[model samples]
Target: MNPKNPYKIALVLLSLFLFGCKDSASIPSEEDLNAREQTPQEESNQRTTGPIDYGYGPGLLPLGDEKISNEPKIGFIYSCDTQLNGGGAFKAGEWINESEGYWDPNKKIMVDGDISWANAQFTLETKGTTREIKGNGLPINHNTGTYPISTQDEAYLYDRNPNSIKEQKVVLSLPVQPTLAATPRCASGMVAIALNGIAIFNGLDAGGKDAVAHEIQDQCDGHPQKDGQYHYHNLSNCLEDTPRDTEHSALVGYALDGFGLYGKKGENGKILTNADLDECHGHTHEIKWEGSLKNMYHYHATEEYPYTIGCFKGNINSENLSQPENNEKPSMGPPPTQP
Candidate 1:
């Protein structure tokens, strides 16, 4: 890096071209080097790295049943103990027991261990010329207690008897084809959902504090709120990383407005920063869509502030998707103010 030694600079470039730094456990990927050299506004020839999924990526993957079933089944989950989920040893459309929530290693009792165990559905709503993908806000992941949630100064637990988790009628409707809006909208609570049917929330906690910064989350960086609804304030990195080329970003979920939500970095193992994103934390470029290449606008999560998304690039059906109980405003740990 010494300017006085031209050979040294040449050696550095040559080394990069031939081989990345030797000290790291892995070498820098080709795309990583290129993205670093270019600024976000500099017009990227860079494309998303993955084949188009038959369904959508992450949140909306597997369009519908790849094939229809003739089995005589009225409902999915069979009993009060059964839960519908596509994560953690359960495949898509499978039901498993969700009674035991996370263990309190210290107290040795299950926390947030509650479920309404009810039927949920997603249907297309068409009235006049409008279309939407509508369904309840209930998650298949059993709502677990995150009571005694720790904050900067104190930990607060909700009154379990009065505040309990229940099936929420949340409707989601996004255009089969999405269009970018002229302005970005704030991502409040319950901004989206994951493929597993879990809730995806905004980056801010009830107090506008960085939720990811202070909340004590389980392995997926998710926890239940006072009402026992489990959700994420960040990408959570919970989904198992599927295989793709080195420069590819994994689809994690979707924003309520129907935009694709991608993982924390570019294919090259580089940590994507806010600098690489717009005010809504996204960009437009070539992406793999339904097994083919399509140029489109999508959001990418960063490791920094507003880790998931800063705003929405497309119009959102807030009333349809926002958690009804959340309208009362969530807590910021005893400060007690409406958001």
Candidate 2:
């Protein structure tokens, strides 16, 4: 059951009536069915929005039955202060020319036709010298002998030096103080606008699903779980936007059916790293993936490079939550062309 349609009020009413008339063995009359059917508006109120868990939103929202906050932390760290064209544009990271083996920001578009680009623009407004950090930490996977690498160019010991891979720590740390610029600096590959870290996208058809996997896995090398949804980090290279400047980044929204950032194991447990991006709550929306590494609030996107996905430092103030600076124009970069 899609948790959104949780328990029905009608069922509750039926139980109450049955208990009240314990001796009555006869089936409910038409009146009971009519009364039950009249609660559609009540059900609508309860079922309109999917389950939201507080864990996913850092205690800001409810995490439902799934622990969506326990996945590996992967993102980028950016400083607001580096803009091009007089804070009018953000620096853009060069797209990779290839599509095999390693992950890169060059291929963040869906190949299929269902999920197209939505002209939603995002900007970074600062109150003071604010610093934004985004990163994902993956647990040590001993079975695959896989580890994390901060950059795409970093050579994994397994591919180059097998013996060295074993000696090295199972976890690889990639740290950077991203410069905030109007250029597309931080974002690369597909980026989902997750609140605190919970994905909030809609549904997708089969082709759209393939397109999402191809874009995410192909560009970021995220491993596909048994359900075929890809989950992995891509290259997030970004520059910072300074006090008087801003930055931008591109994003792709994938339309998936019952898709989320993670799924569930049993009824009450979270499916950490499952084949389903189920933690995103199957709300039949679009998952917006970033094309750059810059941090911005989960809701904004930009065609400019070096994006500030959410709030930026150096500009923080009392209006931190209410007001943000997004001075860039809404323009879309071309979808993945080739390589």
- lDDT agreement with native, every candidate: 0.43, 0.20
lDDT of 2 by residue, 214-258 (tens): 222111122222222223221111101111111111122111110
Stretches of candidate 1 exceeding 4 Å from the true structure: 1-163, 226-228, 243-245, 267-269, 318-339
Q: Which regions of candidate 2 deviate over 4 angstroms?
A: 1-145, 149-299, 308-339
Angstrom error of the Cα, residue 137, model 1: value is 4.1
lDDT of 2 at 133: 19
Clashes of each: 9, 101
The 10-residue segment of model 1 with minimum total lDDT is 1-10
Name the top TM-score candidate: 1
The C-alpha RMSD in Å for every predicted model, in order, reads 20.3, 22.9
Error of 1 at 78 (Å): 43
